[model samples]
Structures are given as structure tokens and as C-alpha cells.
Target: MLPARHRMRRSADFATAIRRGRRVARPTLVVHLVLVEGRDDPPLVGFVVSRAVGSAVVRNTVRRRLRHLMRERLAVLPPGSLLVVRALPSASKVSSADLARDLDAALEQATARPRHLQVGRSS
Candidate 1:
């Protein structure tokens, strides 16, 4: 389980991160990351494991796996970052190692460049 300080609890925070964050999608999950400037707190993480993934039991299982994975990777994020991991149905069938690899890849892609900076550059 994540410490209280590292959890994203407010609905508004989730909304902002989803709406304004950089997104990186993997086969098993989609990650949305928003970097909060000038704040000194530890990065906050949230998870979305919807019914589409499975029944309550399955969802909880996936959530637990993700929480454990995130706890280990939290240090990869900078202070005040907000990260939301939305699990795809495929996530239910993958191993923890696969999930961790996807999570790490997503974070690396999400934070590789500032969103605004990327906006003015040509693809």
C-alpha cells in the first residue's frame, strides 16, 4: 500500500491529471502524468481499475498488483507529480513483471519531454 502522502485522493486532482497530463499507452495500461510545478511534496499516484477489466475480485487483484508496482517505482517521479494508471482488460492476464515493464516504459515516455515544449515542435 502507498503511504497517505503518496496517494492521489481528490476527484479534482484526478480530473486535472487526466485532462492536462501527458499520456502513454501500453498494451495492458494507459498512464497519464501531470507534473505539478513548485510543490515540494512527494509524487501522488492513482489507479483506475474499472469493471471492464473484470469482476470485483479481479479488479481488486489487479489494483493490488499495480499498487505494489507503483510503490517500487515512485522514486522515478519528481516531487508533486500526479500519475494515474488506468488498467486495460489485458492487464488482468499479465504477470507482475510485464506490468512493471509497461509501467516503467510509460513513465519514461510520459516524462521524456514537457507537454508544452512538445506542442511547438513538429513531429
Candidate 2:
């Protein structure tokens, strides 16, 4: 679990970060992942679980698994980036390792995709 200070709790931060950050998405056996790039030492990651994902128990379980995976993979993620993971209904049935694999793949693809903008350009 993220420390109290690092956890994403406010609606405004979630909305703003998600809106501005770039995303890479992929489907897993029981969940979906959405990763957005940001700038923190161990990359900030959030899980989005709505009523559609499952009941309260299921959602909490999934979140716990994701949080564990995030902690395990923190060292490998790009430094100073924000990643938001959105869980699909299917995720209620998958294992933690499977979710980790899905997250890894998503992050790899996100990092590999080309970005259209360059800092030095002028119109």
C-alpha cells in the first residue's frame, strides 16, 4: 500500500493528472490497466474501481493485489511518472501475478510508443 502522503485521495488530483498524462491501456484476465506518465521518484500509480468492477469485497481485494504489484514493480517503472490503472470487471477473478504481467506489458508499450511533441519546435 502507498504511504498516506503518496496515496491519491482527492478527486481533483485524479481528474487533473489523468486528463493531462499520456496513457497506455491493455486488458488482463480479470482487469484492465491504464498507465499515464508523470514525474515522481517511484512513479505514482492509482487504481480505479467503480461499481462496474464488482462488489465492495471484490473491489477491495483487487485493489490490494494491484497495490502489492505496484510496490513490487516500483523499481522498474520509469522514474518521475504517474500511472493510473483502471480495473475492468474481469479483474475480479484474476491472480496477482497475472495482473503484474499485464501491468508490465502496458508500461513497456506506453514507454515504447512515440510521442508527437518535441520541446524545441516552434511554429
Candidate 3:
């Protein structure tokens, strides 16, 4: 389970991350990351499992699994970072290990190429 302090509960935060964060997409999930400047607080993580993924029970299951997966990875994130993990319909059928791999790959890409460092952006 994810701790309350590290959980992202605000819709504004979700919107900000989705709209302005660095995005990395994988087969089963998409990760959006925003490195909030200078706050040094714990990283905030949220999940999105839509009805397209499945019915209510499946959606909740996906959410819970994603939440559990994120708990183990919270320490790797930079301080004050905002992250949103959106689930694709394929996520409903994927195994937990595969989900973890998708999450890992997405995070690696998101962190490795932040906005300022991308091609054609002045240092």
C-alpha cells in the first residue's frame, strides 16, 4: 500500500503532471513525470485505471496492483516529483511482473530525458 504522504489526491496535481510533465509510454501503461523545482518533498504518485481497462472490479484490481508496485519504487524518484501512471486496456490482463517491467521501463525513459535536455532545447 502507498503511504498517505506520498499519495497524490488532488486533481490539479494530476492535471499538472499529465499536461506539463515528461511523458513515457509503454505497451501497458504511460508514465508522466514532473520534477517540481526545489520543494524537496516526497514524490507524489497517482494512478489512472479507466473503465476501458475493465469493469469496476478489474479497475480496482489494477489500481491496487499499480499502487502496490509504486510503493516499492517511491524511493527511486526525485524529491518533489509528481508522477501519474495511466493504465491501458491491456493492463487488465498483464501479469504483475510484466506490469512492473512496463512501469520500470517507462520511468527510466521519463527520467533519462527530461524536457530541458531533449534534442533542440537550449541548455
**Which runs in model 1 stand beyond 4 Å of their true positions?**
114-123
Full candidate order by TM-score, most accurate first: 3, 1, 2
Instruction: Give the clashing residue pairs of candidate 2, or none.
Output: 30-90, 30-91, 31-91, 38-80, 38-81, 38-82, 39-80, 40-80
Could you tell me every candidate's TM-score relative to the true structure? 0.91, 0.71, 0.91
> Candidate 3: where is the Cα deviation over 4 Å?
115-123
Against the hidden true structure, what lDDT does model 3 obtain? Answer: 0.87
lDDT leaderboard ranking: 3, 1, 2
Better of 1 and 3 by lDDT: 3
Expressed as tens digits, the lDDT of each residue in 1-123 for candidate 1 is 887889988887787678888988999999998877666678889999999999999999999999999998888888767789999999999999999999999989988863431221111
Query: For every model in order, what is the number of clashing pairs?
Result: 0, 8, 0
Candidate No. with top lDDT: 3
The deviation in Å at residue 80 for candidate 1 is 1.0
Among all windows of 10 consecutive residues in model 3, the one with the lowest summed lDDT is 114-123
lDDT tens per residue, model 3, 9-76: 88988887898889999999999998867566788899999899999999999999999999998877
